[model samples]
Target chain A: MSPVHLEAVCKLYRGRQQLSWRRLLRPQPPDPPHIALQDISINLPKGNVLGIVGRNGAGKSTLLKIVAGTLAPTSGLVQVAQPVAAILELGSGFHPELTGWDNALLGLALLGLDAGASQQALSDIADFAQLGSAMERPIKTYSTGMVVRLAFAVTTCLHPEVLILDEALSVGDGAFARRSFERIMQFRRDGATILFCSHSLYHIEALADRVIWLDGGRIVADGAPQHVLRDYQHFLDQAPETQTPALPQAGLARGHAALEQHRIPARLRRIRVNGQPAGQAVELTCLQSTLRIEVDFTSDPSLPAPGVGFIITTPDGRSITSTSTIADGIVIGRDVHGSGTVILEFPDLPLLRGLYVLAVYLLSEDGLLVYEELPQAAELQVHSPGPELGYVLLPRRWLPLGNGHAAPDCKPSAHRYIRT
Target chain B: MRGVLLLLRRLIRAYGQGFYQPWQLALRHRHLLRQLLGRDAIIQTAGTHLGRLWLLLGPGLQILAWWFVFDAVLRVRPMARFSFLDYFLPSVLPWLLVQETLSRCLSLLREVRSLYERSIFPLAILPLLPLLLVWMIYTPLEAAVVAILHGPQAALAATGFMVVLAWLLLPWCYIFSLLGIFFPDGAYGMRFLLTLLFYFTPILYAPQMLPENLQDILAWNPMATLLQQLHGLIGLAALDLHHAWYPLACSLLVTGPAWVLFRRMSIQIREAL
Candidate 1:
């Protein structure tokens, strides 16, 4: 049997509609129940990783909650293998006033660990969270990152049969993120079924074997990660820009509290593309126009300058080309006050036709934690003439054909592709 | 005979199906229950220098305040052989159990909804939380007080009666918890109602102190039946068989329906939240 099987699962939120006494005394029609999920079905075999991706309120968290047995579905069947541990919300199931050690025991018990196994799990959590003596202190005193670390540790330490994470993979960066990434990888190696949801398509594509894209509480795409993610991005691209801009990844706001104790990390102050404002769309000739992106940032004088990245992607959210300050070994010089603006210039851009999106990201001093993302910073509309179909036009050298003799109109240059 | 046989069959069937679910969930999550209760015990007395002693001491202070009003200031005494504090002590001990459990039940589900409802802790087990916590705190205190005042025999009797009283209050735990969740107004109203109930019962004054009609009306109170059972068992009041039927009948009448109501409202509670 598949480790996780869901059949025709539907969740309708009929919240307190006719429950009001005032409504009962003088009755009016109740509002329609919100359909959080509809006709969802999946059969995930053991050791498989399934990724859920969707827009905000697209019911990603709702689906995870149901499968994890937190919320029962309104109708239909949900059969998940037992020993399912889920990190639905950060620091959930943890009492703030209780010591982290006590909370871990409680969390393990809720996840169905008995007395014998709890001791080992508790030790593992203490080690994984690296809180050390902080484990003896109440959770209220720990920073948010420490809480997430503890929650993540307790949830994953048991090697649950089905591991569920909702926007939790962005646990903190540097050693802990890498440690968490390795632990999740270990869960996969140990044949644990992982159900992961995230706004980062990069992580989803790298980690998920199969992906399900939810739209309007229904499964719009489900298949191989690349195929489904492409389809979802295309769907989003075709959609009008009427909806509000999506919220940045939730982890972007994390670590600020801890950082406050030390120094302010780098943040995107301003950006300009080819002398145009970052908000407006800029047109560029495929090979004739130079794509110049200038970025300004400010950070604490004591801290080193933060790294910056420039990414260009298709309208369907697929990255075609990327570069960064750290990758090129370029150290941004800081002024006396540790604030500076640096310009990145690319002469004669070779991007092909069609509309594209570019985003500038700011990383911490360690260059592992992505502190902020200026998503959709600008639209780069590349104009390429002739019949070229794809993201980039690679430079080519056509060797002499027919002993260096070539026709004038259909010359050796005729076979040579002109990008502009 | 037919009705008795029918009750037997229903009891057996309930035992087979939904009746034991709460118990099973309790056993399944027993460790979590221990941790939660332990945490509550610590938090209740943490900031105080006295620590866990405040479990008994805090309630002791409240009773001291009452003693100043009724015994010292008002100079009230029961017509019975025992002093007013002696008359008040045994009954108030049981009343403390009811007050603590019922009052906490008003916010029990609300407080732990996020902690348990969204996770594996069965929501059905929530109503039992207040009962168990209060029972652990007050049951021994009642027996200790009885032993100190009366004798060993009455203390033993108080222990047995408190256990029985705890069982009888189980259904009300579920009932009040549901009421609190569905109607928040019930929580505010229940506090005032409990205070009125304290005065209405014979815990503070003798029944003869009130008019005969008021005494007649107070006898109809279901809580009075519980208090009467406590007094009779400990050899303070006459062991009246008239109030005996209510405790047993309330348990049998309400246990099944309360469980059903809890199960029925589980979905609604999640949505409402």
Candidate 2:
């Protein structure tokens, strides 16, 4: 049996309303619950390292919390292996007044250790925390790094059969962070099933065998870490400087978009490539005529106009290059009717012989919450006549062997097709 | 013992098996529970000059105050066969435990909300916390005090009574702990009510001092029955099993609803926090 398994799990949270005489008399309907997770299902076998990645309010932490058994799902079946230990946050739940030694004892005990095991784990924790004599002192006096060290040592020492971590790798800096990471790697080597949720794609790629990407309480992508991270990284690349906090947080600790169901932020209405009517998968020639793509969208009229973003990637979702109105600080103009049209022109399309997918996204005015995604909406098929190689044709020319002068037709000029 | 076990089993089985969850948490994390209880004591006395001695000193000081008021200032004596000190000493200690436990329940969940936020803190065992702590600290101490005043037999009987009292207070513990989350003002309301109950209990003074009608009212108070049984154990009053009916019935009535309410509102309590 899989160490971690979930079927159609969901968690819903509703904002609390204050009691008032008016509310008592008027009896207004309660606001709709915020969707943390909806019909999320997973079956992670033992020794499988799973990573969770998503934007703020994406319910990655919610899914982790559900699996960790901290938060009960509003609905669905969840079967996880026994003796699950979790490090959901740094310096989580330690009393400031307690000594480091005492805190470790408590932490290990909280992780389901009995008295003898907790006492035995103390030496291991002492070695790992490296607090030395300072371990006898109260935790409040210790530096942030010291607290994190102690917490990490206590959590990892038990070698829990099924360990779950939420951004715990973002431990304190310098040699200790590397040590902590190495310890996680050691756990992986020991065949422990780990469910790691982090915003650091690098860590996810380095550690996770599988990855799940969540958005608006739903799984947008789930597969190999590389593939899922590519999709998630693409979303982040589109709107890198959104107003909403991009920092990942533990489940239910970060603020959620309450009553998100009631709002219609933005939606893609129409798309046209090079003035040709678009199909579900529009195949267009590259390195020939100029490529003009038009996107028509609608937004909530009362709110700020949403941003438009598009990405060109290999068929497997490794992003080649992407552009966004938000990233360029361009304010999309929308009419009072909430309809807006933006046209992107790629002159002298220089993409070489390759099949590329174009994805369109409608971002919220703040450029964080993705309103709609048309993934692989358009496919570009390029077959160049010249004997050039690579995914992109550089704007350059080869000089003749007998002379230093370049051919007149192949002269280098300041153009948009500069290779990186 | 067999009869008691049968009733306990019936109670657990009656509560829809959710009763077992708290038991499981308590058993699985018993070490954590012990550590947390120790931590609570450490936090109370950590910075203090006297340190762990303050556990007894704090109570000793309160007992001194009560002694000064009732014994010296008011010059109150028991209306029954025993002296005021004999009756007051045994009963007042348990009342103090009740007062502290019920009052402490007010902010119990809130105090640990941050802890539960980032970890899967087993909260079902929380209400049991105050009870267990009180039991750990005072059960032996109170029994010792009873032994010094009475004899070994009375001390043994008082110890059993204290144990039963701890078990019986579970419903009250859970009720107040949850009320502390959903209705914070209930703490203050309970405080005032407990003060009223303290006067009515017959712990401070004997029941014979009150009017016939007020004495009848004291029959419903569990603390009164506890003192009566304790007094009986010391050979100061008649030992009758029939008087035990009200307190047991009261526990059953309170526990049935308290456990159900906790099981139902356990999730909501976390949200409220």
Score every model by TM-score: 0.80, 0.72
Which CAPRI level is candidate 2?
acceptable
**Tens-place lDDT digits, model 2, residues B1-273:** 999999888777756444355567688778888898988888878888888888888888888888889988998887445667777788888887787887777777887776677787777788888788877778888889889888889899988988778767878888898878876665678889988988889877877889898888888787788778777876667787778877877776776668777877777776665
Find the candidate with the highest TM-score and give its number.
Answer: 1
The regions of model 1 sitting more than 4 angstroms off are A242-309, A313-347, A351-420, B1-12, B15-21
True-vs-predicted CA distance for residue A288, candidate 1, Å: 4.6
lDDT against the true structure, per candidate, is 0.79, 0.76
Which candidate number would show the highest DockQ if scored against the true structure?
1
Residue range A1-420, candidate 1, lDDT tens digits: 888999999999874563456876898777778999999999999999999999989999999999998788999899999788787886778888789998898888777778788997888888888889999999999998889899888878876899898887657544466577668778889999999899878668878899999988999999999999888877776776533333333333233343445334555666888887676699987777788998877665676688888888766666678888887888889887667777888777878788888888876554545656777778988887657787777765555678886544432222344634
